[model samples]
Target: MKQNITDLSVLELSNLIKSKSISCTEVTDSFLRHIDDLNPQINAFCDIFHESAVRDAKLADAAIAQGHYSSPLHGIPIGLKDLTPTSGSTTTFGSKLFKTNMPEHDAILVERLRKKGAIIVGKTNTPEFGHKGVTDNLIFGKTRNPWNLTKVAGGSSGGSAAAVAARMVPIAEGSDGAGSIRIPAALCGVVGFKPSFGRIPDVAGPFSSTTPFFHNGPISRNVHDSFIFYRAMAGEDHRDPFSIPTNSSQPTKPLPPLNRLKIAYSRKLDYFQVSADVENCLDATIARLSNLGYQVEEVDLGLGLDVEECFMTLWRFKLSSTYGGLKKNELHLLEPTVQQLISEGNKITPAKYGRAIKVRERVWDIISRLFSNYDFLVCPTTSVPAFDIDKESPRRINGIEINSLIGWFLTYPFNLTGNPAISLPVGFCTSGLPVGMQVIGQRLDDTRLLQFSETIELENQWRS
Candidate 1:
């Protein structure tokens, strides 16, 4: 019975809890038990709040008995990325420097989730300051993929992705500066959604930038569960100056039916070397969409200028500015890669940074115009499948060398453009590792993108 609860989606669990078919205490206990048994192998959680979660579960049961009902997430166990602050909980961002740091107030998203009756079970692990795509830090160690423990689980949201894939939790919060959520979701065989910039409130912190390039969104096993969590965490917040005012009337508008759609599929965007397995999987996905009455065409996204150079400059600048005030001793505790990036950022002159910003805006303008002709853009989430956990980055993809971190981060451009993107499991590689297809929509069209993803999943029957 406990095993059965672990398989249920957030919507499914919510229905059972509402109908009294399962008590909140039962659901919480089931998750807690699973985490206790499995977390040792996966390293998905940095800290567990078992006692507080049990107490919250009991309170939920009492409310249900008294005829009080909360939001759809009531009593569902969820994990928080250690980057988000949780009042009274040790919210280490996968760093030894702040291992004992605890916040007196919850982050805006955490406060919203608590109000909606979701019980946070623990803080999931992340790379130090979420600086890299792989989830390993000097403090909490590495988070292994549930499917194949030896392979890497994409990060900085690796722990959240692993937890969802392993059924330790139904949903989790993940922040994406550049494919952090989507990369792990692809590797872990789960659903990852990055809502348009400013759609979800982002609380400011040492790593947070005033620019709306970074976003916090939900990662779940299914589309509806992601939607439910997204709706709950979204809306205007005075604390985040970039948060947009969501019009209630807009959500009520019926989604435009996705029939006879035009999809632009790019296997290798501007000569990007892709793995044969990923190419084959993407071809199959395009066929499926065509069978569902859509037009799929091979399009070339001629993005002028060095996109990697521009994005990295901006990214490193943000990191440097965000953490520039740390003491030298505290800085020494950071990962070597992080320290290297800070040094590079420190060397970037203001004039060079300004030029990079302008280049980003020009690229966005071009991509936006391209979307006007196509309903959505499609590409492989990553150029290659999950690699060995011990390797820092893949040395080669399809026999081509990848020299730097940004070389493998093909999905970062969309993040820079603030487009709504989702990574859906398409197929697996010969190594038995998962491959994912990225469905990208224009900014502020998150709901439509989600609806289209549901169509794709249903047509392909892609369930883990």
Candidate 2:
């Protein structure tokens, strides 16, 4: 039972702890042991709060004994992405610039996690300032994939996904600006969920992005744990004007049988090139859904604007505006890739920025109306499967050139539309890397999408 505790899902662990069948200390120790053994190879953690986690676990046990349960996540060990602020803990955004920085208070979401009695075990790694989709940063080095140590773990939430996949933690917090959460989850073979915009608050800090598309969410081994963590961190916070009021009492219903549902499936978003493996995996997944009784049809979402140009224009401008005030030394501290983006952003005039926003709004208007006819949409999370850790970006997909960062990120459009999207590990490639299917639901239909994901997960019996 002790040996198996570390493998249990967050829901299972909560049940065990609540039933007194297991102590929080025992659960924490089991995870600690797993991290100790696996983390050296994966480099998933920047720091491990072994003592603090054990102490908190003991306190959770005492509270349970006294008939006081904090929340669903009580006593569960979790890891925070280093970008999320943690009071007194080293919260480097995988950058040398913040090596000595510590926050005086936890972010609003972190405070909520604490209120729910979750024991934060450590901080996961990210790219410097989460600038790119890979997790290597100057501060704590790179976070490698657990499936194959030599391969790259998709980032900037790479460390979080790797930790969850390697069973270092049952669940971990991850922030996604442009497929940061889903990308890593796809590569590391776990579940990554990015809820609707404003579903989770982005706390006030230097690392926080002003763009509505940026979000903080969760990465976990399974859908149920993802749901649990999402619930724990969601709700309105005065700290973030964008935070939405949540109805916790709203029940999540299982998805209607696939035969009763209409889904729009597309490999390429009209013009983007999809790798052969990605194309095959998506094709097989669509067929599987059809077999399970879903009406799967190929449809092109004529996203009128050049998605890459529009997204990069906006993304770069936001980064430049946010970090432009830094001194020369601070600017030089940024990675070359990030520095290049900032420079590009600086060149965009205010008129161009406004036009980009207009383009985004128009695109969202088109996609939302399309969702009216379909229950959900499906696509490949990335244009290609996991690539070499050293390569900044794959030059081509299925022998077609990928023009820019957003071209490789096929999943960011939904984020721009403020819709809830999830990445489910559907199959593995010939190289043994995992393939993920993006399950996107209509705006504010997060619960339905998650329930559908669980059904698909069960039907396919996909285990990582």
Candidate 3:
């Protein structure tokens, strides 16, 4: 039987389109139809532009017929997290405050994706202002895991991850701040790559110049697909001053054999709590790496339990500084979690924020030292599998009280240190939900990270 268009990877679909064996319209229709059938229950997308998507796909088909193949993303249907602004489209940052807000220009990544011939299908849902780790908001409700409806899809890229997991799109744009992209990718059993800071120019909207922890990235079912998106979006734009100005994304050297690579493994990043099933899956993954002839050794990161405290300090301040100017009525319209964040941000003194910066430097020192000895660091992406969709985050893990905000998150430290990290769906929990294994590389070494992840993807053949 011929495989469904929606089931094929981005490269597969691109080949089919490039060869004229299948038109872009057919592929777009397949995905739109699939979205029509599945999106109601999954609630992965807050907006679906059926007419414009078909129009764009038809344009792509016309271009391909004229012998124009833009890139691997050509003619592919992709979802943008609602937080990503699209010119002339309603780009609600998952908050009612911006429900009708439309931008006059696309975000740098969005512009790049379009220039590469990728069609934007619609905007995926996200938590209000993407302030939390769960995908629930006043505007779009909650996005549920495609693996299990009762479980969350993860956030703030939850909608993008869920859309990719459900095969509604082969790949989608996701942003990571405290693992927003990686968190959802892990929960939805997809690949999410958080490139080293500024690998992808993020110049637009309120965050155009303010934050460094936040990253614009990609989510897909496999590493190769994510790599394609990364290459298309990576590179410096004059607009984002922090954007890395180099051709470092292109790999210059071939990868060394797996046997020659040393991988550092940590089950828990110090004080984080992980559930039993996730722990088991993580152990099995490490053993698989060992059996693959890779030297995998357990290590104590010694990041200390207070890591989350410092992270929250920086996060809250960012939130407060960004949205603290809202009028009283506007504040009430914001998500309670976001309002709380702004309130918390107000309490953060300049000295406390300064301390957080010092803590970030410490994190960088520790992770940098680890990378000096090991080629990569591997760990569970999230401390637990998907949890209840309605809750902001789990109050406890393994029956122990944890911080409700980001306590279960194991991804923020890398974000803090601006390391390149990718999440691959390694295995499943006892309850049949997926578990992700995170791979971290030295700063600005995104190319090597993708190569390593592709190796593992080939070995394990993970798919949503």
Candidate 4:
């Protein structure tokens, strides 16, 4: 009967529930208390399902009392990113137009969660349609960082990252098209895992079917909970053509031996200029991992990765293809930034988008060759630490101009490469703000990534 159980990892809580040390109702109540008290300031949740969550918790407790256990996630509370739809819950997608949107059925991932008996706590906020890097949206205002409420939590999975960092929920679902999960995780000081594309099947809305960039992943305070939650939701779904069978690719594989690891550590990944504070912090983390005999070495990507042109071209095309066709009258419903993005997207030529696709393939080839020699690749997750919540994004970095809101992020290139990447809280800046180091694994080798990440986590002792 710990009074402050909100901080316990999901695995610990699951064990407690199994042993009857704490009823599911009690677990639910502890988090609800935190949500009621902290959520007002964090703005992490757009909707909190207190009544339904309690009902579900009681059901979970009764199941356990009857000598039954659904899964490790049973009785564990988690938040679904607003981009995902859950039956009987508002799937706002963090948009004003969909403010009253409620889906008749849960997304495939949500259905899997219910099967695992996870308690659905609420919907975490996101940028409308997960458009930008920063988390603020017109529908529900902004989600602030828990580490320092004045600083912005990176997005479009901003709410999920903030909620996990704030301990509003032990785990929250996050979607990444272009560093949506890793960006927020880095800013908020949490573990955000974006499994290799297709590892977790997405809802695959019309536009989603057209691209392979979007991913459904997990955000949490630790590696163990993330891997567990990922296993529960990861499997083939008929609805998602891109879905991979869990049996064919076990994300639960054991960690490889440390002596066998040949990791590539890059400070800037070749193009971005990392802030002085962030660079210093990453240098310390790399040194620590080096001393631990991880066989790490610094290497430049050499791939001319101001990849903004190719990536953003595809981004605009994706946006235009997805939102450009929406009825003209409905355009007013979007936030101004998103509306502007859609407008720019509509202007992209088919010729330009095609060239960008070719560039993406070339980028993947380069990364693939590098992975052939390295067990893992590491770098600072974002070039800068968390910025002000009031601004759209850092307009400049190291006195140089940034092309877009996401220009400062180092996590997006991996998104383009379809690699399993993660953000682990490594160190804090002079102002006490957290900095994250990104690690990417071979394509479809998520298990190895988590194993290596666990090693790094143990070495660094990351705390939000």
Model 4 regions lying over 4 Å from their true place: 206-212, 249-256
Off by over 4 Å in 3: 203-212, 249-251
What would the TM-score be for candidate 3 when compared with the true structure?
A: 0.97
Clashes of each: 0, 3, 0, 0
Clashing pairs in 2: 258-293, 258-294, 259-293
TM-score of each: 0.96, 0.96, 0.97, 0.96
Per-residue lDDT of 40 in model 1: 99
The C-alpha local distance difference test score for the whole of candidate 1 amounts to 0.86
Which candidate order results from sorting by lDDT in descending order? Answer: 3, 4, 1, 2
lDDT of 4 by residue, 1-464 (tens): 54479989999999988889889999999898899999999899999999999999999998998999989899999999999989898998888888999899889889989989999999998988898888878878899999888889989999999999998999999999888999999999999999988788877573454354888899999998999999998988777777788776334556557767899988888888789999999999988887877788789776675377888777777777778888877998887877888899889887988888887887798899998899899999998888888765777889988765777888777778889999999999888999999999998888888988998998897752
User: Would you list the clashing residue pairs of candidate 1?
Assistant: none
- lDDT string for model 2 (325-380, tens) is 77889988988888888888889998988887887887788789878888888888
* Candidate 3 per-residue C-alpha lDDT over 317-342 given as tens digits, one digit per residue, 9 for 90 to 100: 88888889999999999877789989
Clashes of 1: 0
Q: Pick out the ten consecutive residues of candidate 3 with the lowest summed lDDT.
A: 203-212
Q: What C-alpha lDDT does candidate 4 achieve relative to the native structure?
A: 0.87
By lDDT, the best candidate is: 3
